[model samples]
Target chain A: MSAPAKLPRWAELGLLPAVNLVAALLLSGVIIRLIGESPWAALKLLADGAFGSQEAVGYTLYYATNFIFTGLAVAVAYHAGLFNIGAEGQAYIGGLGTGLVCLWLGAWPFWVVLPLAILAGAVGGAAWAFIPGWLQARRGSHIVITTIMFNFIASAVMTWLLVNILIKPGQQSPESREFAANAFMPGLHTLLGKVGLAFTATPLNLAFLLALAASFLVWLLVWRTRWGYALRVAGQNPAAAVYAGILPPRVTIAAMLLSGALAGSLGLNELMGAQHRILLDFPGGAGFVGIAVALMGRNHPVGIFLAAVLFGALMQGGSQLSFDMPRVNRDMVVVIQGLVILFCGALENVARVPLAALLARLRGEKEAE
Target chain B: METYTLIVLLLAATIRVATPLLLAALAGLFSERSGVIALGLEGMMLGAAFAAAAASAVTGSVWLGLGAGIATAVALALLLAFAGVTHRGNQVVAGMAVNIMVAGLGPALALAWFNLGGQTPQLEGAGQRFLALTWPWADAARAAPFPGLLYAELLSGHNLVVYFAAALVPFSAWVLYRTRFGLRLRAVGENPSAVDTAGISVTRLRYQAVMISGVLCGVAGTYLSTAASAGFVRDMTAGKGYLALAALIFGKWRPYPTLGACLLFAFTDALATRLQGVALPLVGVIPVQFILALPYVLTVLLLAGFVGTAVAPKAIGAPYAKEK
Candidate 1:
């Protein structure tokens, strides 16, 4: 095989992702056309719907908050060489934690309930993720398979709990009672309104700020800490880590714990932040979206924030598009998500090879000049 | 007498329910045995289910639907091959992309074409579905007592796919252990370097395995839509592909053992359906959710070596770049 050409950092981080996004969008346009709609018109509507007004931006940010939590969750595990697909399940269990705290202490002040709720959510998510980590580390089972299994198990467990035990008395639907006003995560609009600043009410909440904080903490934990270095080393090369006296199994367990905790934070945004109660399927495929976010973001916190926002835009816009253009629905966004995964994750090198050649040619010209 | 009839009916229902899983497990057996992770089995099945249901609904021909399903699944498998075999990308990630893509694409396309909220129109005419075929002398044998119940209820009436699935286990066993192609396919999964040294193209063999798996998955999906139900429902596969994957691992990647695992899982599913609200005397009312989750729980335990160890193909999930 010939030696492969290399590209600069700008091309690596920026141009490559942009190329992939374009490829995904172009294909999405084809699907849109296949469904008998003009892709340009749809694109226009989508952009307008996502960013045309303050309310749209608020909803976009609201959705972005959930993506950030799950994206960080996935990124942490990816760094540890573990494919933790159990984020959906962990988020579900985490919501249960948040819900329990809120239901029991709904009468308490916001300050007292919020801290405990966050802690309970993290602990719940981490605990759920711990089993898969332990199994992979000690029992020789594949973490991917175990995590996928846990997602289903989580669904089943939640169903049983909700239907049999936790369903609000005399209610037919499988959901918990509403959390008290004190327990609700105040919406951003409401909070902003108190400061003499006016904004349209949306689901956007303080959890968006919480998501930003989580992203920064993850950056610190994954890049700045000694444990983070060990985790990265273990992920990149187990043999090298072992040679350097780092226990891979321990790192795997720790990474999963952190991943699960990050995923668990999703509930704070969706439940305490928006819905204000636990419900079935509240994760609503955000865990899977996190995979796409992490992949598109190249597993970086900064990249994740950008990718999460883009996806949030897609979510907000796609829903609006579906309302106007009945032919195109929210599933169109799912199709986009899948194409993004395909382009960014699976077929990542498709654009890289050609782009590398181009860069190598440019360098050759520069040398000759 | 009533209880005896119900037992026979339940056993028959078990066979019906097991068909799709058995086919899908065999499909995974082919792909994973060739060293490519078949996580996209769910996606392939879902895509084919929608294709089959749509074609059947449109053309009113079950055969066309079957053909369409196989073609769709083959196309998907080829995409998997391109990413996994040709590009040497992460097999798990690629497989998952296929799944997630189909999960959305199927529903989106369905809504666009049929406009029934991500569902195909109901298949009605006789030609649109694979109706159960009663065996010769089925009615004649129903007149007897025990023999009648066994022959007519337990063994006779089932769609063609169920019979094909039953016959497929022994056929798969023969092909795996007895055929030259099977040997090479298995060898490529175990050690592609050895296969490459022997002048066999690892890529071709892996692609062939994936294609075969895709066809089987297509049939499984077709069975779900055309035979098991009258129309395609959104997310109708409902993790059966995963269940089949679990069964594949539980069976230790062997044909007969995998069939047994499928049967066990199917029996549980049948039981879950029957015991949905009924309370038993000794066991009391078992949660249907627990029964539904049993297969996943058992597979995890099996993988953990709590019960027995399942050794995967050595070269599985690793991209083979030919040595210089």
Candidate 2:
């Protein structure tokens, strides 16, 4: 066996996030240069578009609301060593549930309808994910293959439901009718203005506050709860966890269910707060972006929240960038996100080797001599 | 039609449906057998489709287009192998990166190269298409009512690569079970350290397997763009490569069973397409999405219920490193 070396405190606690941010910026800069755009100009445009005005800040926060939930979903599963790749499908199912509830209970008050709709969404999301989770936990099937396959199945099912069943007749698009006014989240634009705190025209809502609350709850569960500790232990070493009498299959299943529920909450927020109806591609790419967020954050809740905000800014700014730099496609944002995930995942393995720390100590000793 | 005719028709549909999947599954077999999990097969197929369309448009030779597709896939496989085998990078992460890169790059390049947006210019005339095969005896059997070109066309009349895909089943089975090189390949997947100690180079063997997978994926991509369809469209392969990987697992990593799994999925897809117009009682009310979802739902069910004890090759996704 190899000797166990003491890890430096800073490397273990702080260096990773800083390194990821630096790597993300460098890669984004390189991508900008490759596309023949000036990096400084792009950065300035992004800053202005994301936070230049109170309206911009509100919009960024609005986008961050959905991402925050999805990021937590991914982090929860990662902590249990279950890669929940079916978040996209689960989110779709959640949106469907939210829509159906709104249609059925359109006369209900906002106080009652909203909570019931969100709960229904969570249940739908959990049910959608349970199939793959049960398969993996009970039969030892690979979660990756099952979840990937489920995404396609869910897409087809959702499309069919939208077109044939849920669609209001004569509408060609895959979408439902407008949601009841009671189902809508109270927009912060009017409320904040009434309170003399409004500085923007954007419509932030209760979902943003819920997103922050969800992140804090996740942080608490992961760092303090016994179940979370067991999940982490199982993730870190399944064989050892099994030896210690922890049922890995059960933990994996629970983690995946929770992940799906969180993803479902994102769909609820989008349906009730932003769009007020289910539309095709409503939660577009947020599920996939959550993967990058989880990776960039090193699967930590606080880290995922920060990463989600960064991406939310990029996405919100990317739309404005289209108007300013008409030649550059907004897809450059996707490329940047992909590069960050790639580098961050790769860096995780490299960082554990202590080569950088060893070199730093050696240089300091040489200087002393 | 009589029961015999119905049976024959079903058999024919199965073979035709299985062709692309069979080719892709064979590709998966090669990569996984070499201890590398190729999650990038979807990306490789997409790249090959684009390249084949561009080459065929420029050269006016379908054969040249086929070659271009294979070459492109092989180049991608080399990249995957380099990161996975040589640099000892995380195989899944590298594979995913390659996929994202291709998804982004393919459309961007198509826009720049073809100027047709996300599609290629369609090919014209029978000269650029695959010809069907016919049999004299089958034609003469009116009592038996054997399908003339239909029988041979379903089984053998495919483009050269379709035949190659069928041949790969028996050929791969033979190579894997009978050959010395196959033994070393299996050894490397099962125990790289043991193989390294036994004087075999793990890197070289793995590189060869991954390259072979690349070539096969390239052929599959060409078949999609040129043989199956007249032109390439954006994201034409969709998720077929991933489905083939699922088939690989469903087949329990065996050649024959994997081919069977491919046929099963393809048959369901063909059935779904054929059922689009029919309105048969209560089931007719079922949405097209339900039918389309059949294959994947069945795959999940089968994996969860029936294939209870499948085992992957040892060290399947682990990158091999030399000891200091």
Candidate 3:
């Protein structure tokens, strides 16, 4: 076989994303038209509904907050070469932990209760992720299989707990009791009102800032730390990492655990800051949506944040778009998401091959020197 | 005295419950052994179930519906194979795309085509109903001197698909272990490079394996809608496809052992259904959801514990790129 060529410049990597986005939007428009909806009108409605008012912006940010956390969770694992599909399950279990803590022990001051709940959520999420990680690392079991199985197990466990153990009396819904007053995350409405910027009630809270902070932290952790270097090495070339005296299994496990903890905190944010209680479908498809976000972001923290915001806007706007266009389902957002992932995957592959060939050619030149 | 009869009833339920899983797991064995991970089984089953119901409703022929179901599944498998093998897309992502697309598109299409979002019109007439067997010994067992063939009821008296599923276990084992085609397919999965050197097209072999899996998944879907429930419902397969996948892993990706794993989970589901209200011993105290979760929990635990060093087919998820 012929030797591969040299790497493509960074400009090429930058151009590919723009091309993918355009392709995705065009495809989505065609689909909308095929469904007999006015594509332009729908787009207009989407924009108007998502950002027309301060309240809408706040809601979009609130939704973005959850997506940011989950997206970062997924991105972190992807960087480590682990497909952490159990984020949904981990988020649910974490919600349960946060909910229980808030309900029982939230009488403490707000600062104390909030951090404790977040910690509990992270720990719960990490533990949930550790199961599949352990299996993958130690037994060489596939993460995909274990994580998928764990999703069902987690759902069943939550359903059982909701019905029998944690059911709030007289509320027949599959939900836990509301968190105590002190446990609730202070919404933007409260803080903004003090500064006279409040216009309407919006659930966006301190958690959004925390999610942003977490994204920066993840960037640093994945790029700056010695552990991060080991993870990257292990992911890119496991055999090489082993040769370098790194325990790949431990790195894999730690990466997955960290990924899960981030996802778990998404649930905590929703429960304590937005919903103020754990509902059966609280995590919903947000965890899966995070996968799309991570993919679109190319597994970068900043990219994930932007992608999450875009998705969050779509979701928030899509719901309102239903009022203007009654025939279009909110699930059209899912179609858009699917299109994005498809395009992104195709783009990534197309870019990688040429880049790898280019890198190989450069290496050959260096060897000749 | 009646508890003995109840135990017998439970045994009967186990076989009944095991049928679909047996079929689906067998289908998974064919695909995974061929080096393609058939994550689209759930989608295939769902699509088949929809097609089967629609065909049976229109043509009023159970056989026609079953054939349509299988055809739909094959079509989907072909699409997946084309994308994963020919287009060189990531198999897992492509499989997942198929799954999400089918999950969404099936319901929408069902609504558009049949106006049935969840439930289809129930099957009617002799053509629609499954054919059962009646033997003289079986009759004698139920008669005065004895009961009907105790074993026949336990095993034989179901639809033809049940026997077909049970038989496929051994047949698949033979195919995987003894056949030349099976050897080539296994070689393609284990080492596509080696297979390519032998002048066999890895793409063609993997495609064939995936198509076979689709056909089986189609049959499984037919059984689910027509034979099992006599009607179609949205998301009727539920997570059974995933369960079969789990069983495939739990069985360490082998044929016969996978069948056994599927049966074990099916037995638990059947037992859960049977013991829902009856005042039994410790088992009865378990909630239905816990029992429902047992299979998944077992799969995780087994993966974490017993399945040390689970080795997938070497080229399982990699898209085969011929030398340029």
Candidate 4:
């Protein structure tokens, strides 16, 4: 096989990723067909469930909100040459922080609790990332392994907190009691209602707004700011960055803190907005999912946004598919997502050969003409 | 005293629990030494566990179950190796994606075939499970004194997998250090160009390394489902793959060190299991969470404080470029 030749702007920025995504979806379809379900029917259901109705759209967006935070978190770190796999643990700890703040200020108004809880969550998430970040910067320990270990550490800590220490008097399940109504953040339905548009009720809440704002800010920070330039430069070449007066340690620490904070806010959407209670496995697997999102998005803000939406659609739609189709279980949905992750992120190069050949041939023809 | 019995039980449990960790760490040793990190070790182990249990239950043959488990793990390894080593895509991402795929496929396939809540049917009867090996003097041990009892309790009764796990360390050490193939493998991990210049195929070496990783993981998984427990459950490996990776590091990636690290983790695990309720003098009553978290915390500490730029093979996680 020939080496991958560079593609034009559109293909590089768009066509290639789209092809990879389609390849992933097709493989997922084959997996479904192997299980005796019609892939077309599954796709139809997924599309309808994810986008057919207002409520469905709302749920999709709500899931997207968490993904956005996590995707952006992973992207931020990636741009700085760090793979922040600790986002799951960071989100868990961030939710812990959100839960603590909401509990402490249970009687407070929404306005008072919201900002404080967000801050607490950010701090909590950042704190969890700090040790690994510090080690990577100072001790030369690899961040990926340490961050993963931190996930287990966070899970054990969360389990300990939820079960033995905070098991809500006599509740069987290891979840805290619902937070006070005053601590509940406003949902998007209420916000939309205030704006005179009727919308379906959903877990989609002010957290979605926070996530959008974060996306915009990240785009600005990474592309439009001087600090971002330094971070990227450090990622590209640490020696050159140092020669140019950028400190690797400082850049690493800053990027990680920002990444951790964004990841942590993913929990706020669930705990403070939707569930209003902290529980076991609440982050679920969103942190890992963010890796796929960021990879598919190429670590860009707009790319991450679109990627998050697609994954969000898959999740919300997959849930409905499992409910409607007994043959296709939740594990099937996971398989699809896994396929997406594998093709789009891991085996992405599989498509580069033909694409590069085609692109190179077209370029040569144009030059000859 | 009661402490003596507790000590013996804890030691035995330590070996029992350490078996999976040892096998998995040895698996990690192969992959990492050949420069492809097996982050999907968790997924491979979990998938292998489910496959082994399900196959054993269906065929009523422990060997068939082991084969099935090995086949699944090697299949996953092939995917990872193709992506990471051949296509030269990112190794960490490829491994992670494979892990997610395995995590999904194991339960999904289990559900399709068994319909028992993503769990395989229990492995029953004599051939379906690995029976504990009995010593020749077991009858006399029951009738006789403390030494016999100690011998019976400590030396006898572990399943065949434990013995295999024990033997694998020296075997791996011999393969990795004493042979020409081992020399080439280590050379490929440290400097692929040097090996390639010597007319060795780096791709072949790495593929073999990763496949060896797959085989070790299969053994680890079979032990988990067939011997460690009666059947496969969802996420039965828990985080043992990562624990094994940590042990690989804690052992400093050497055969002996890896074994010692697994022992330490297993000992801590046994302590956590045993010391759940008992109060101690110096430390007071330690919480179980602390003990459970001990292995992870130690791994982090080792990475941060003690390792001090000492761990990991050079060129690890890097794709070897043939021309560049």
Chain A TM-score across all models, in listed order:
0.98, 0.92, 0.91, 0.97
The candidates, ranked best first by lDDT, are 1, 4, 3, 2
RMSD of each: 1.5, 3.7, 4.4, 1.8
Tens-digit lDDT string for candidate 3 (B1-324): 466667666767777777777777777777787778877788788879878877887899989999999999999899778767766766666566566556655554454455554357778865874556554466556543224435557654677878888888889888888999888878888888888898988888989999998999998898888888877886788888889888887787788778778878988898888766566666446788878998998887777676443456776777777873
The Cα RMSD across the true interface for model 1 is 2.1
lDDT tens digits, residue span A227-312, model 4: 99998998888899999999989999999999999999987798988998889989989999899989888888889889999888
| Candidate 1 segments whose C-alpha is farther than 4 A from its true place | A1-5
In terms of lDDT, the poorest run of 10 residues in model 2 chain A is A1-10
Residues A142-245, candidate 1: write the lDDT tens digits: 99889999999999999999999888999999999899999999999989999989999999999999999999999998899999999999999999999999
**Model 2 per-residue lDDT tens digits across residues A184-270:** 877777667788875555656887777888888888888899888889999888899999889999998888888888888886678
Where in model 2 is the C-alpha error above 4 Å? A1-56, A199-204, A243-245, A323-327, A346-363, A366-369, B1-17, B58-64, B86-89, B121-145, B155-157, B281-286, B321-324
State how far residue B255 of model 2 sits from its true place (Å): 1.7
Model-by-model DockQ, in order: 0.67, 0.37, 0.36, 0.60
Query: How well does chain B match by TM-score in each candidate?
Result: 0.98, 0.90, 0.92, 0.96
Task: Give the clash count for each candidate.
Answer: 0, 0, 12, 0
Interface RMSD of each: 2.1, 3.3, 3.4, 2.4
Q: Is candidate 3 or candidate 4 better by lDDT?
A: 4
- As a whole number from 0 to 100, the lDDT of residue B250 in candidate 1 is 95
Per-prediction TM-score, please? 0.98, 0.88, 0.89, 0.97
Q: Look at candidate 2 and give me any clashing residue pairs.
A: none
